[model samples]
Target chain A: MTLRLNLLIVLFLSFSALSFAQNNEIPAVDVKKIDGTTFNTGDIENDGKPIIINFWATWCSPCKRELNNIAEMYEEWVEETGVKLIALSIDDARNMGKVAPYVNGKGWEYEVYIDPNGDFKRALGVNNVPHTFLVDGNGKIVWQHNSYSEGDEYELFELVKKLSEGESID
Target chain B: MKNYSLLTSAASILLAFTLTFIGGELKAQQGIDDVLNNGEIRGNFQLEAQYYQEDSLIGAQDVPEKILSNGFLNLIYTNGSFSMGVRYESYLNALLGFPEGYRGNGVTYRFASFTQEKMSVTVGNFYEQFGNGLIFRTYEERGLGYDNMMDGVRVKFKPAPGLSLTGITGKQRLFFEYGEGIVRGLDAEFYLNDGISALANSKTQIILGASGISKYQPDQDSRYVLPENVGAVAGRVNITHGFFNVNAEYAWKANDPSADNGYIYRPGEALFVQASYSRKGFGLVLAAKRNDNMSFRSDRTEGQQNLLINYLPALTKQHTYNLLATLYPYAVQLNGEVAFQADLIYKFDKGSVLGGKYGMDVQFNVATANNIDTTMLNDERTTRQGYTSDWFKRGELYFQDINTQITKKFSKKVKGRFTYANLIYNQDVIEGKPGVPVIRANVGIADVTYKFNMRNSLRTEVQFLLTEQDQGDWATAIFEYSYAPHWFFAIMDQYNYGNEDPERQIHYYNASMGYNNGGNRITLSYGRQRAGIFCVGGVCRVVPASSGLYLSLTSSF
Candidate 1:
């Protein structure tokens, strides 16, 4: 009994050490917006612009909800703060055929790109869909969120405003 | 000596990596296809380390102590439509939790010849799942850490639209090697709605499929004449009429037995019937199943996934919510089971009384399973079909459950859900350990969320589970706070109030925080993860409860 208890304690300590070793606070990733042209990350970051990068899928319900929510407020968001939102669809070829139709049906204003092989998502370490990354004008990632609810868009806009003003906040 | 081997292998891998880099650079400088004509070499390696602790109360202990290390390396070369790959796997100090004889690594090869025109042939380790995976399925689930690779060759012929044929011959995977049996199978599927005239007249769609798998395992026991070769045949048809869909499949296996029925060889049979109705936001499904000693295997003597000939699918909703999922995981029994399940989901329109502001979603599910009745066979019978038994006797119900859930969004800032489930679980077949009482469980859960303005929100969940058998009663409470884009925090506690063991009657609590930036999100949590049933396929392994802080970081590039 004592041995089992001690083993549990050791496992706990090791896991705690692993948790501490994980760096939770790191500077945001700097990335350029995809437009079928102009693939320069440094120039995009130096322009002091806020970038909203959302990793999504065509079949994932939460991704649909997040994109629809942002679409409903995309006009207001752009007018309020000159922020650019980019939606990356990670749908493979099996489901990629639905992406164009789905986006057209929703009438989203954000730029859309395909990460069919999930190259960009892996680079960003995204494990789940509907993961959003907030990158500041300096192209450094400032904030991120996974999943979405009804009112999550409101919170997103607040961060966009703050980041556009060059404020360091969490 | 061990270090020397490691150094040699490491040097080889480094040399390969450097060569690949230099090859790519040189190709960029000069022209392409220089290395490709010589044969391109591409490889990838993966390593894993695991720590296992035993839990004795649930009969999940008895594993030998060891630090487990396993890795796999795959090297592939592709030219034109022909490709070849070799995979090597090694496990040093494999823990008792894993199967035996998985210590050494060797090369496993794959050669595939394919064309865009008519046919594709593959000779190597391959994964295939037939029709929802009933009669045959070979696949890998890395997280739960299970793989049933097929060491065989397969051919797929697609001469025309709506018709396809596949045939395979191989053996199932056994720890670091192959099972001691051979399997041969053939499957053909035909779609009635495509390239046909009779079925295309009325929006009617039909799919007909037939599959057969024969397993051969040599018998060694002198006391009983075990059928060295057993065969199972399954046929399924799916017909869709308007908005209603119906699918049915029937499978039968020749007589074969082992330790389950006292080695009384009994030819088993199973039948599955399912139907669903769906239009828009509302869907309903009903299914009934009956199975008897239908545990087809490559080797009847070895249990687990040794020589699985058929796969039985789970009939429960695969839950994702943390609190709802951790309590009980359903396990399927192949010896004998007569079961049925039903699911209904309806979504209410927005701006209604029930829908409030956004919409309301309600779901209900119920499932039940029972043992099949059997008659005593004369001890003198031998040869042919083995033991005789009744096909469909309504035996005692081994398990039953009913669940109902409701979700509604009152406004853009608030949403909530209410769920309740009543379950009856048989411990004998599920836990596999005798003397554990059957469990009658009643579970209730409520989750509510309220957003504070735009950038902040708070969500809370409370759950109560009452049971009189086994571990008794439990109650859980959870709270989460999200600060919009960047940060979120959660606190949760689960209390066992009716534990039969006094030492197990304790409260487990956890606190967690998460920060997401760009494509990376970091979550940190400290808490006690209650040991519970972890199941893949129809088999389950109980995980022991432990207090620990866990961190997981995943990235893709």
Candidate 2:
């Protein structure tokens, strides 16, 4: 009986510790926006702007399209709503050199960063790419999407517009 | 102080009582508990035992008689936004027929992991794979007794609606400890849908991704300057429209040679193309792949056993039958292979003559691989310059096969299936060394199942194989009696009857019964397990012949 009790206690403690750690881990950054520069999550939400941070890579075809599409409408989106779009590139050193060139060639106006170590990526449990998260002005993630088609972006923008206007998104 | 102590005692006692209750319930042989219970621990376990005996016909003298045992216990707990689990494995002498050094009983993984909205993290041992697993794949294979668990840290995040990122760093498993090399990787995917203002109404959809992995292993050998930092980049794009879906990827790895080629560096590249069309009851799939020296690794000196930094995708069917599967299992030779496979499935409409009382389903598949043509060497004097190996040019077809299977049902109680396949294999590259007969073979199998009632059924299968080389011709038969939700009895036999030498012949037979009660299943059988190559992916482990009793038990809690 004592042995069983001890085992149970250990199990409970272990899970409790895990739960606590999970809630406290740093929020995942938009790998496409990091650019090796240190930035805080609060910086984007400081101004009343809703922030959309996307973790992307140069070779990721879906990411490339997603970034390019967003870039085409980025300026208009900023003017319409106080929303900041940040692209974090997760390209390692092998392909990191191509990040600036690729972004420049695309003529995207949004901010870009690098997370070569994937510190921000690992913080989030992303299994597949083209995953997106929408953060409120308070820096709390409220909505997330996995894969995207052309039509899905319209729905996402609608949600972002609603969220920026203080309308219910869910 | 006295009041505080009293409260603490009460809380502890309550916790103890709760644990005891759960443990007591578990001791009664209960099913797997739901993991949603934030404070409860759930687990599953499996154990197997086998004995081996040598037969002189195939010259199986190197075999040894031994008992093999392997089992694992996993405990998982989740509370609110946090979750964690630890798995312990006791391979103890592992399995005699398996690779060496897998013979220890220890806690293989002690992990703490958690996930929230945008971030998820894991520390300790984990299993992971990247992009068709061409660059890095760490996992476990019980049947083959191969586990390359990585001990490290991993994280994944998504900061926007169309982008996702992942990063990992760790060392792969070598027996019970970590391998000598360090592996690190990054992968990201972006969806173009959100950014494409003009393509919003287009019927076509596209997703693109890129990934990179680097492996670092310190080398002490003075003779060779191995690419200490082996790296690879992979890109994939997927598009779908109407009934058509296509995914294509290209991966390239820097030059890093190995013991197979005496450390002569050769770069590697792999290209994958897959397309499928599915609607209603009809589905068609086409896949083609080309692999050239894509066997990335951390340690070039190590044999084929460890230090594999990538897994070559197999283009052949993973057969499960005894005779057809054992004769020639395909192994992806990373250095050179170009293969393609096509699969078609069509179901006959009801009320048709071929469909009879029930619809009939037909499946056909064909796959083949060949070596990449290459100049053995430009000249003996050109020491540093590597051999010229062309990426294209179907050298000699190393493997080729086609299979057709049909399943049909008559009335409600009778059903049957017929399968036929023709296969060819190159024994030299697949079986370590040459001189063994290169196999050109045809196999046919027929299976019939008859159900007398809701609870009783009988199944019979017969197989005939015709081959002129290797182990000669073969015949097989199996009969099974099953009672719904409870018991099953079966008898199986296989004979190598067409061998040239009379003494080089063998017949294997087994009778077994399996009982399933609730969450527990137990099986017992006595027979001869033939010596054959059991493979997963491109890797293979030879399962030696065994003539003995076998038992297996599995349960979850």
Candidate 3:
């Protein structure tokens, strides 16, 4: 039994190493629109512009702060780079009802969706909220961040600027 | 021993099958590019370890194992419409305040699923929930060490664009084992606008759903006669028109005595209703819920957040502030309770008098819970009917809170939020404290952020609580500094100063720093943690007060 377990672990590690070398893209999963209709995540697009996918929840304080900060500069970013931001709320059934109201109350201009059962969240391998991902015009994920801090939106905009200008980021 | 061998064999078979499939695909394609282009593998990993130090002053118990750790890794492979995943969990000796059943390590979850046309099938472990989760739900909350995933087979069929059906047969997971009962359920949902062509373009949209669930457990007890089979049913409806929405659900369960309700044979019932209205800068929500003898479990004798077959959502504002959240968190009373909540949010314009230069946002919320009025029967022992409850009478106050918050931008580089709250907590009922009087308290907080440049910023919070019972008055202060996309440092102190006994009045201080780089985060901190109840969505676990050094790492691909 131990031998088989060891073999499985070794194989798994090697597979992970191989996968790490490949370019990752967003996974296709089912989410809900703010109006209570099912929407396929594969259809998310920004007309060949950079797309910023942000995973957040209504109850997470840092997630709210991050979204609010980005909201303040979203118009400017769009005008300059033709960027689009999509906010995904990972609120469960208990708190799902408050999401639309909360978003409307804040007057946020970004497109918002709900993942009530966290199916999309799990497919994306998201461990925590406020995890942001930057996707290039070709639909390939280029950069991602796990947590949020003050002034992080500035850094995110910088990446968007680079991606729009056809500059590579390491 | 037999179960262990069975699981090991199953895992080995799965691994062999996967290897064989990959080999065959490679041979058929004559290259690895086909598999690499169509197939994807993704997962996440998290680990938390704590080194404990005994502190008799704050009631932190000595640990025989000075170091404890909890960790898990998930790996999922998906190819087109087929996917398979597994999770390996390790709890070395289990962390303090966690269930002792998590002593070792194993593959706790494994599943294979496929979708073809409009039908989906899942075999092995899965998580599922019915409408509102009133009658059935199986999920995981890692923060509370709670997971009730089902080891089962499930089938879902979408007959049309707006109609769906699901059927499931499984056994609920209990720690490293399976519950004694076998569970089976069926659910159906219909969207009116999508299902009927006539209503497709209507202004009003409606959705209706219903579910039925049953569990079978063998009666083996010698002391009393028990029912072997229990069943529950629920129905829900949702309506939306313009900017208004309403959702409601009702559930009922057959009488099956269990440990949570003191072996009462009374049937269970629950009702939840919510209404909301929202526009661009204004929103309002009102909700109410009532539950009676609704603690349904697969096992008859299990207690303490275990083996729950249904979820009773707590109707309260989930506070985010430390003092307001951790100090007096409310837990749902599964047996019987009536609760209501109201919330209002409004945002002033950018250039208005109250909005200042940037804009201002205000939110007001109120929530309350009360015990169900009940009357004991004359021959309750013989009938085992327990007691009868009045449908409209409220017995006693369980919990209440009224709070409001205002957020304003002072300038281009400054933003602030202020909050005030009043709370009334019944210690005896909610916390299981006998003979303790109710606690009435007021809390206030001010949080502000200052930006020095585009890359550097600092945020601070000052908070205070005034109370005459329990831990008495308290104050807290927090400071955090961030350097853009990479690093952050935070420090906070919580002081209990108005205790009758100064010896018990102590200061809990903590400092932490974190580093984040694209999909990976690492944090290390050392601090004195005050004992409190930590909750998520009304479900709670007691977090013990401990002085320790903590480290955590999370990563995803």
Fnat score for model 2:
0.00
**What tens-digit string does per-residue lDDT give for candidate 2 at A1-170?**
77455445544554455433332212423333322223444245527557776777754544754675576477888888778877777654323434544454344566777665444543443323455667766565656654433334555677679878887655
Clashes of each: 13, 41, 0
User: Sort by TM-score, best first: what order?
Assistant: 3, 2, 1
Model 3 ranges with Cα > 4 A deviation? A1-17, A20-23, B1-37
- DockQ winner: 3
Worst 10 residues of 1 chain B by lDDT: B28-37
Q: On residues B135-217, what C-alpha lDDT tens digit does candidate 2 reach at each position?
A: 77675555576667678899988777667688999988876777788899998876666446676666776668799998888
Better of 1 and 3 by lDDT: 3
Q: What is every candidate's C-alpha DockQ against the true complex, given to 2 decimals?
A: 0.08, 0.02, 0.53
Off by over 4 Å in 2: A1-170, B1-37, B52-66, B194-203, B378-385, B536-539
The C-alpha RMSD in Å for every predicted model, in order, reads 11.4, 15.1, 3.0
Lowest summed lDDT across 10 adjacent residues in model 3 chain A is found at A6-15
Model 1 lDDT tens row, B1-557: 66344434433333343345445555321222222233333334445544444444333344354345565655444333343455566667653345555666655434443333457677777766555456777655432446676888988776667677789999887766688889899888777766477666767678788988888889898888777887888898777776566777788777776655457656677787777766556667787887777777677777765556566765654443444455665666778778788877776766777766676777788888887776555664554333455655667667787988887767777778788988787777676778777878898988888888776888888998898877789999989888766678999988887899888777778898877544345667776667675543234555566444445443321
Residue by residue across B288-371, what tens digits does model 3's lDDT show?
A: 999999998888888887888888888888888888989887888988999999999999999999987898999999999999
- Clashing residue pairs for model 3: none
What local lDDT score does residue B165 receive in model 1, on the 0 to 100 scale?
Answer: 79
Which run of 10 residues does model 2 chain B get worst, by summed lDDT? Answer: B28-37
